[model samples]
Structure formats: C-alpha cells, structure tokens
Target chain A: MNLLVDAFAWIFDPAHQAGANGIPTRLVQHLGISLLVLLVASAIAIPVGYLIGHTGKGRTLAVSLTGGFRSLPTLGLLIILALWLGVGLEAPLIALIVLAVPPILAGAYSGFEAVDRRTIDAARAVGMTEWQIVSKVEVPLGLPLLIGGLRSGTLQIIATATLADYVGAGGLGHFIFVGQKSNDYPQMLAGSLLVIALALLSEGIFALLQKLVVPRGVVANQSTDVRRPSSRRVAVVGFPTEERK
Target chain B: MNWVIENLPLIGQRTLEHLALSIPPIVLSFVLSVPIGWLANRYRWSRGVLLTVLGLLYAIPSLPLFVVLPIILGTGLRDSVNVIVALTLYGIALMVRTTADALGSVSSDVTQSATAMGFSPWTRFWRVDLPLAGPVLLAGIRVVAVSTVSLVTVGAVLGIKSLGLLFTDGLQRNIVAEVATGMVATIALALVIDFALVLAGRMLMPWTRTVSPKRERRALPVDEAVTA
Candidate 1:
C-alpha cells in the first residue's frame, strides 16, 4: 500500500524530474526509438505487403514468416544481438525492427486484402490502369487496416522499447533495471506505471485514427453490418469485433 | 557447439522448467477465457468494455509486469508463481476476444436447430457451439501455447529459472553458444507445442479436415502474437 504511494511520489518528485536519466528523458528515448523502428519497418514491410496483397501471392510465406518471427522470444533476441553487435542502440534497434515488422507486414497486406474484389473489378471495368487502381482504390480502402496494423505495431514497439536498457540502450526500462539492481521498488513501480500510461495513450490515439481513417461512405455502408463489426478487419490481435462498437 | 553438447542435460532441464512454467497459464487462461468470452458474446453491451479492458491488460509489457507484480501480489521477487500468474493474465487477455470471436463464428441456424431438438443452452454449448467453435478456439489456444512457451524465458531476468536463464547467464559469461542454445530450445519448444496443438485439433475436430484450405487460412492471423 505504502509502496504505491512512494511510486507516485517518485514520479512526481521534482528532483527526479530533471536529469540525464530523468523521466522526461527516458520517455523521449522510448518514443524516439519506437518511432524510428516503426518508420523503418513500415518502409520495408508496406511495399512487400502491398505487392503480396496486390498480386495475391506469397501470403503463405508471409504468414509462416510472421509465425516464425513471433515465436523468437524478444528478450533472448535482444541479449544475443547485444552480444554480437556490442552494447549500443544498434543492436536494440535491429531487434526492435524485427519485432515491429511482422504486424506491419500483416497489416499492410491484409488491409489490401480486405478491400472488396467487386470494387476492384468495377475500377478495372471503368478503364482505370493498374497503378491508378492501386493508388486510388486499394490504398484508400485499405488505409484503416493499414493504420490498424500501425497501431498494433506502435503499441508493441512502445511496450518492447522498455527493454532497450537490457542491452544498454537507455529508455524508461532503465529505471526498472536500476531499481531492480538496488531494491528500489518505488522507482521500479514508477517506471512501470509510466510505460502502462504511455501504452494506453497510444492505444487510444490509434483507436481514434482507425475511426477517422474509415472512408465516410464505407462507414455509412458498414452501419447495416454493425452487428458483425469485427468480421471485416482481420483479428490481428484478437481485438474483439465488438471493440469498435 | 561443444558447449551445447556438454550442457545437454542443463538445456533439457531448462526446457522442462520452461514447459512447467508455461503450460499452466495456457490451460488456465483458456478455461477462464471461454466463460468471459461467452459473456462478452451473449451481451452486446459488455463486449466492447470486456475486450477493451483485456486489450489494455495485454499492452503492459511483460518485464515490468514481472517486477511490478510482486509489489501488487506481495509475493517474493523471484517467485515462479508470479510468472505463472502474470502469463495467465496475458493469456486470458489475448484469448478472451479470440474466444468471443470463435463463439461468434458459430452459425446461428445450427444453434437454433439444436434448440429445436430440445437441447438446453448448457448442453447446446458443450455439444454444438463449443464443437462448432472448436477450430478457431484451437487456433487461439495454439497461439497461446507458442507465445506462452516463448514468453516464459522472460522470467529468467528476475532470476527465475527457464531457458531464458541461458541468455542472461551466457551474456554475463560471454558465451554465445549458451544463448544460441536458449533461442533454439525456446523456439523448438514452441514449435513442438504448436504442432501438438494442431494434431490435437485434428483429432478433436475431425470435421475441420474437410474445411477448405482457404477458410482455414482465414481462421489464423499474425495479430495474436503481435499483441503478445
């Protein structure tokens, strides 16, 4: 009980608020690494996912690839990479990029996959070129799922980035580690509270983005299908179909 | 390589320890999630709230959970039960929505027919809805199994024993082989469990064998592990 109070006190303490290892500093490091990883991962994954979805090839490969990567324990990978690459952001960056790729890739292709085939066929019948169809039709329709993927990817990277300190890359996890090393439970709790808050905040932002990204017309059409809400978006994270409701 | 060969018993022991720590949460969470999933599915209003809360529960990272749980639960810092409890929470969070989706996937007509035949809701769920939802539930549980096995390694950082012990110990000792062995063992354990789940699914739900490959592919997705 008192520990919870101390944790809140630690977070609010003015002295703890302004240093190299301050809460603000660690938060930036965490978000910075997460953003960089998301950007790089999206760049690499989005194109390949688009191609696969656009062509309807290599889905089995992508699924297997994601399953394989997903099973590779993150912490183990982080430590091994740190050992091989030497202690720095480089190792953690690579490891996190790997972690971030699968969801983005799944999101990219699946977003394209979610667009109605009849819609694409109509676009073709209207004399649209392949590129025009892709840029104009598929991308917009797929944007919500793509953003959904990004949202999941963003949440994951934020959560995992806390472990950057394990490889000597500083983030909020540093507090958890430092506290663990010295038995400072208050600091450890404070760090965890911050990470949870950040994750929830990001989840909220992405949820809003997902809502806003839906084509207004599609939203109108989807109203009839409200009872079956989750059927359209592939259950990427087992998000309840009713969650959107 | 020699280091791996010499540490065969140690590796095997760690693998055993990993399974011991992992299987309970997978089973417990699956059992617990089904009812909650049923509740979420049965009540339209509760679905959003239940799923959202569970989703947020999962977003909290594992390591922090491991450290923070002792403070919350008043367990020892290195307690294995803490890892089990934390993993179960994660498993339930991930599985609940999947379970709801699985139950939702059941055809309404089939349930109505069963009802017309005089089966009560309880009997209908066990004999009809659950079996019909079997394939998806199996996929969800398979995901839970693989991820739980892989995640058990994280506990080693707090000095709990599992294959992850190899990574921490190897790093401190500067022995790459030990860490590599740990990675292989963890993946191998996950694969074995995943394969076993598939086989079990086949045996338990033989009707799924006739389901189209295309339909089967749609049933599983990458998001389960992503959220984990």
Candidate 2:
C-alpha cells in the first residue's frame, strides 16, 4: 500500500515534473518517437498495402512478411540493431520502423479487402475511371479499417517504445530501467503507470477515429466493423479476425 | 556459431524455462476463456463490456506489466509467477475474444437442429457447438501458442529467466552470436509449438480436413488465423 502511495507521490512530486529527465519530457519523448515511427511506417506501408489491396497482386508477400516479422522479438531486434549500429537513435528507430510496418500494411490491405467486391464492380459499372474507383469509392470506404490499423500500430509502437530505452533511445522506459538497476520500485511503478496511460489514451483516440471514419452509409452494412474487436489488434500485428459476412 | 556450441546447455535450459513459463498461461487462459466467451456470446449486453475491458488490458505492454505485477502480488521482483500471471491476463484478453468469435462462427441452423433433436443446451454445446466450433477455436489456440511462446522472451527484461536472458546477457557481453542464437531459439520454439498445435488440431478435428474447400471458404477464413 505504501509502495503505491510512494509511487503516486513520486509522479506528483513537482520536482519529477520538470527538467530534462522529468515526467513531461519523458512523456513527450515517448510519444514523439512513437509518432515519428508510425508516420514513417504509414507512409511506407500504406502505399505498398494500398497497392496490394488495390491490385490484389502481392498478398502472398504481405502475409509472409508480416508472419516472419511477427515472430521476431522486439528485444532481440533492438539489441541486434544496437549492436550493429552502435547506439544513438538509429538503432531503436530502425527497429521500431521495421516492427511498425506490418500492422499498418495489414490494415491498409485488409481495409480494402473488407470492402464488398460488388461495390468496386458497381463503381466501375457506373463509368468511373480506375483512379476514381480507388480514390472516391475505395479510399472513402476503407478509411475506418485503415485507421484501425493505425490505432493498433500506434498502440504497438507506444508499448515497444518503452523498450527503446534499452537501446539508448529516449522514452519513459528510462525510468523503469534506471529504477530496475537501482532497486527503486516506486520509480519503476510510476514509469509503468505512465506507459499504461499513454497506451490507453491512444487506444481511446483510435477507437473514436475508427468510428468516425466509417463512411456514413457504409456504417449500416455491418461488414467492416463486424469482428473489429476480435481481430488480434493492439499488441500483435496482423492476424486480424477474419471477415465473417 | 562456435559460441552457440559452447552455450548449448545454457540455451537448452533457458528454452525449457521459457516453456515452463508459457504453457500455463496458454492452457489456463483457454480453460478460463471458453466459458467467459460463451457467456459473452450468450448475452448481448455483456459482449461489449467484456471485449472492451479485455481489449484495454491487451493494449498495456508486457514490460510494464512485468514491473508492476510484483508490486501488486507481493512477490519478489524476479518471481516467474509474475510473468505467468501477466501472460495469462494477456492470453485471456486475446482468447476470450477469439473464443466468442469462434462460437459465433458456428452456424445457427446446426445449433437449431441440435436443439430440435431433443438434446439439451449442455449436450448440444459438447456434441455440436463446441465440436463444430473446433476448427476456429483451434485456430485461435494456435495463435495463442505462437504468441505466448514469443512473449515469454520479454520476461527476461525484468531479470526473469527464459530464452530472453540470452538477449540481455549477450547485449551486456557484446556477443552478437549469442543474441542471434537467442533469436533463432525463440523462433524455433514458436514454430515447433505452432506446428505441434496444428498437428494436434488435425488429429483432434479430423472432420475439418475432409470438409470441401468451397464449403470451407464460405464457412470460415481459417487461414486468416495465421495470415490475417
């Protein structure tokens, strides 16, 4: 009980709230790294995923890549990159980018996959151009699932960024590692609390975004969001619960 | 490579420890999830609350959970039990949803037939619903197995013994071979376990094998359990 009290006290201690190593700075560092990684990952992954989902050409590539990457442990990869790159942000940044790609890619392609095939054909039948079908129809309808991919990717990055400190990158994980070394249990607990709060905050924001992007008429269909909760989102990448309708 | 040869015993011991920590959560969570999954699927209102809460739980990272569990459980910081409990919670969060979805995947006509045939709900679940839900349930369990095996490695960050020890130990010593060995060993364990689960699923649910592919496609996207 006292341990809990002390940890809360440590977090609220105004001393811990300001300065280079303070909670706010650590929080920003964590969110900043995660956001950067997600943006870059989305830029790379969304294009490729969109291409695959649009063309239906490289699904085999997406599946194998995500499966292989999913099994690769974050700690092992971070250590290998750190060992190879010799610290600084490069190691963790590269590792996080590699890990973040799969979910976003899965989301992009699966969002397209979730769209009814007839809907695409109908867009074509109505005399729309190929690009028009993609941009005006597919993109609008797929937005929710794409955002879902981002949500899970954001959640995964935030969680894994906490491990970034192990490779000498900045994040709230610094406190946990430092506390672990010095046997400062309260500090460790506080760090854990901060990371959890960040993860939940992102989850909430993404859930709302997913709901908002549902493309008003499409929301009534119940096709896209059917198993959204059941898909192995959040921690693991891909393995989205299969579309049932 | 030579480093791996020299550390074979250490690697083997760590692999065993990893399995020891992993198996309980996978099994226990599956046992706990089925009923909870049934309850959620049985009642409309419970599904939203159950899935949302569990989803939030899953969103929390494994590392933080490791550090915080000891505080809650009053165990030593290094206790393997903390990893077990944390992983079990994660497993439950994952499997409960899968279980509910798997049960949901069972066709209503079949269930209605069983009820019409004079079998009670209990008998229907055992003889019809569960068995019919078997393929999807197996898919969910296989995922749980692979991920559980992989996640046990994270426990090493807190100084808990598992295959993850090699990463931390190797990093500290700057032995790339040792770290590489840890990665290989962890993936190999996950693959082997995944394969075993598939084989077990085949043997236990032989009817799934003979089900026609056209019907199979219409019924469920079982392969998505691996590929999404």
In order, the Cα lDDT scores of the candidates are 0.87, 0.87
Candidate 2's residue-wise lDDT over B104-184, tens digit each? Answer: 877776776788899999999989978887887887887787778888888888899999999999999999998899999
DockQ of 1: 0.36
RMSD, model 1, all Cα superposed?
8.3
Candidate 1, residues B1-228, lDDT tens digits: the string is 999989999998998899999989988998999899898888877888898889888887888888789877999889999999999999999888888888887866678679999999999999998898888889888888888898888888778999999999998998999999999999999999898888988898887787688877666778964665
What CA root-mean-square deviation does each model show from the true structure?
8.3, 8.3
lDDT (C-alpha) at residue B139 in model 1: 84
lDDT for position A44 in model 2? 100
- How high is the lDDT of residue B89 in model 2? 92
List DockQ, one per candidate, in order: 0.36, 0.37
Model 2: docking quality category:
acceptable
Per-candidate chain B TM: 0.90, 0.90
* Model 1 lDDT tens row, A1-245: 89989999999999889889899999899988988999999999999999998999999999898778878998889999999999999999999999999999999999899999999999999999999999999998888778878887887788678887877899899998899899998998899888888888998888888787778876666532122333343445666764443
**TM-scores of the candidates, chain A only:** 0.89, 0.89
